[model samples]
Target: MQQLSWLPTHPDLSGAIGQAKRIEDPLQRLHEAVKLAAHQRDFTLTARLDKLAAAGIEQHAAAARLTPLRVALLSSHTVDHLLPAIRVAGLQRRLALSLHVAPYGMYRQALLADDPALNAFAPQLVVLALDAHDAPLQLPLQASQAEVDAAVAERVDELRLLWRRARERYAAQVVQQTLVPVAPPLFGSYEALVPASPRAVIERLNAAIRAAAREDGVLLLDLAWQAAAYGDGLAEPVRWHQAKQLVSPTLAPLYGEHLARIAAATAGLSRKCLVLDLDNTLWGGVIGDDGIDGIQLGQGSPS
Candidate 1:
């Protein structure tokens, strides 16, 4: 299933865009367009906004309130497909992002080696997106809890070191993407009790990661929990087996949105503010027409 384009562009978006384009000031026109696009989650909308926002930023970045942010994505899997969505999502929050993607499978090496190119970029935020299959822990299916505990500790310890390096080496905020638990249950309901089971170890690693992240003041992408929330929409087994794309191309846009939200928070530009209309929302009917006494209020009205 195509997750990215799950829904077509809204039928009314074109009319809305036409109205926005009619505005005399370019920045104001772009502002209105962004306001409309920010509330939508569609591939077509993202693509258009990606281009439009880029040009708008180039012309009136400061006036448009486009906050410039430098981001680095160090991943063990393919992530190029997700960039457009990330940029568009940033624009939604009025952030103008500049990104650096580490060489494939070279996430650790780049940071460890202090690659010249990466150092040149000097990213303000670093995202570590390691895949579960890439973890070095190798436990027998029947291995003991002690063995599982040691492996989980070692993996998270290495991650802690990496997080520390990111902060000390570059003064960058770190966002660790939790290892996705893609392994199928080996013993059905009994799997949780078996630490050596592939799924169990991943879960253990995720828990350890969260604890360490909290202690180290590192932010978490928490893919393990995201997968639980996204269900089958997070990824497909076929894509993983065939192309090593840990994230499904169909859901790449949503994935980008998730990452962008983290970036926004780090920049203090997170989407926390909300505006709402009161009609039929805080009450059962329009407050203006019905008035306070006439509107539904905990059995106070029509009773």
Candidate 2:
């Protein structure tokens, strides 16, 4: 969506022109001058902000706060880069922060179970981190048309039995655990979040999820926006490369700022407790290979 228009121009047009002359790149100089004038609420300085916004250039300063609200952060990934921005934004909003890590599946299971402690926290929102590796399906299909036709004919004879069995199994599962409603549109659209999937099937599944959610009145927060903004598709190798580059000192701040914006967007939600895997996540070396003292955490040579 297009952002609002730029503010009014400043009284110091001559000074801005002088500064613009000093910049080497004519276009860049104009951009800088326009930005300076815009910040000063000068409309006559130019319509640069509107143009930049149209080009999808986000130039707002990092959000800052002195007294932040209480917020909880839940994620499986390291939050080193995200934390600073969140902290800055939270401070600006007067937010208090709490961080937690937990596996997505386990967290979902817990939420379904309606754990009192989880409910007691009464978070206004929750962020779920989903990875492509989580869902794997084994479908029944054949290469040849003859084989398919034969299989279909045989399955027709057993359709009644299959339906009964499927229904029974679904009912049993419902009795054992809560089933989150999943329907179409939103569910189908989410397939785009994956890198190597067939869009049609994903869309169908998404549609089903949306339908189910509508029927059950369950909220489904789509992270497609955030994923598209940060994810580098399903190529694991490429994602890893991008992640390394993102963590570099020069780039980390930009990532941090983006994270802060995300956190700010969901500021009211209380994050669940972080569940850590002790084996290799917390320490530099595996615990089995090295004693507790040998494991690198706070200091010493790299494990």
Candidate 3:
């Protein structure tokens, strides 16, 4: 596999992971496994950790290491695949997460009607994620700027109402996901010039969402920014067509990691300190082993 460049390395990581799993004590096993999992970023490893953490929590062992956080995931599309990964990612930061996901297309119903189950779960953090397909304008290719503005604003206002309701009713922290730009370009480069194209309306809608979120003190998951790096592969057209999965299940681990961070932040568990290694981080290669000149740094060097 592919390596996640951002996370640092761990020597004999597989061996360490295997050893951690054999600890017998479910609580201790999960604690050790989470520490090892943080030293590397492998989806396979992430999946294993997810399983371990779930088992540990289910066993009802000593939970001193786990910080409890109840989360409400209100989304327009299917997000069941991302739950395990989100739980494990939260465990990496010592968070024990419990999720309340709105059923099917019933997210608005759950929030607006204040569904009894959601009210009982009492989420401390609420995430609102909508897919590109959920909100679309019925306007023409050459509609006026005013027409586009009004349509986009109406969608933003609807979301704003939901955010305010969640905060007021539950006193929960709210996070909004920027809709992924999965809609393909219709007019190629000329698409940007069209005032009322689907892409144009979505772009304007996302802009309005950012402004609304800021004004309402809503934290943003910024899925649009994350989707920009993965291109069409991130959304996976096949899964979207067959299962209505806005994000591919293959990317559940990565998606969960990001979502968990936002959830953790709401709980005041966001990383406050980062300690870096001098050898590989400050200068590429080992300075002591390779000597000073062999290290990559400064002009024409890679660090």
Highest-lDDT candidate:
3
Model 3 is weakest, by summed lDDT over 10 consecutive residues, at: 57-66
* Candidate 3: pairs in clash: none
Against the true structure, candidate 2 reaches a TM-score of 0.34
Q: Compute each candidate's TM-score over C-alphas.
A: 0.82, 0.34, 0.84
Residue lDDT tens for model 1, 1-303: 344343345557656766666667767766875676555555665665665555466677688877888999999878887787888777777787898999988988888776898899999999999888888588888889998999899989888888888888799999999998777789899999887888888888889999999999999988888786566645567887777788865676788778888988888886565777666665677778878777775554322
**Candidate 3 lDDT for residue 205:** 89
Screening candidate 1 with a backbone cut-off below 3 angstroms (N, C-alpha, C), the clashing residue pairs are 4-250
User: Candidate 2: minimum summed lDDT over ten consecutive residues — where?
Assistant: 172-181
Off by over 4 Å in 3: 1-3, 10-18, 41-44, 58-62, 273-303
* Number of the candidate with higher TM-score, 2 or 3: 3
Q: How far is candidate 1 from the true structure (C-alpha RMSD, Å)?
A: 5.2
Better of 1 and 2 by lDDT: 1
Off by over 4 Å in 1: 1-11, 14-33, 271-303
Candidate 2: residue 160 Cα off by (Å)? 29
Residue 41 Cα positional deviation in candidate 2, in Å, after optimal superposition: 24
lDDT of 1: 0.79
Model 1 per-residue lDDT at 25:
74
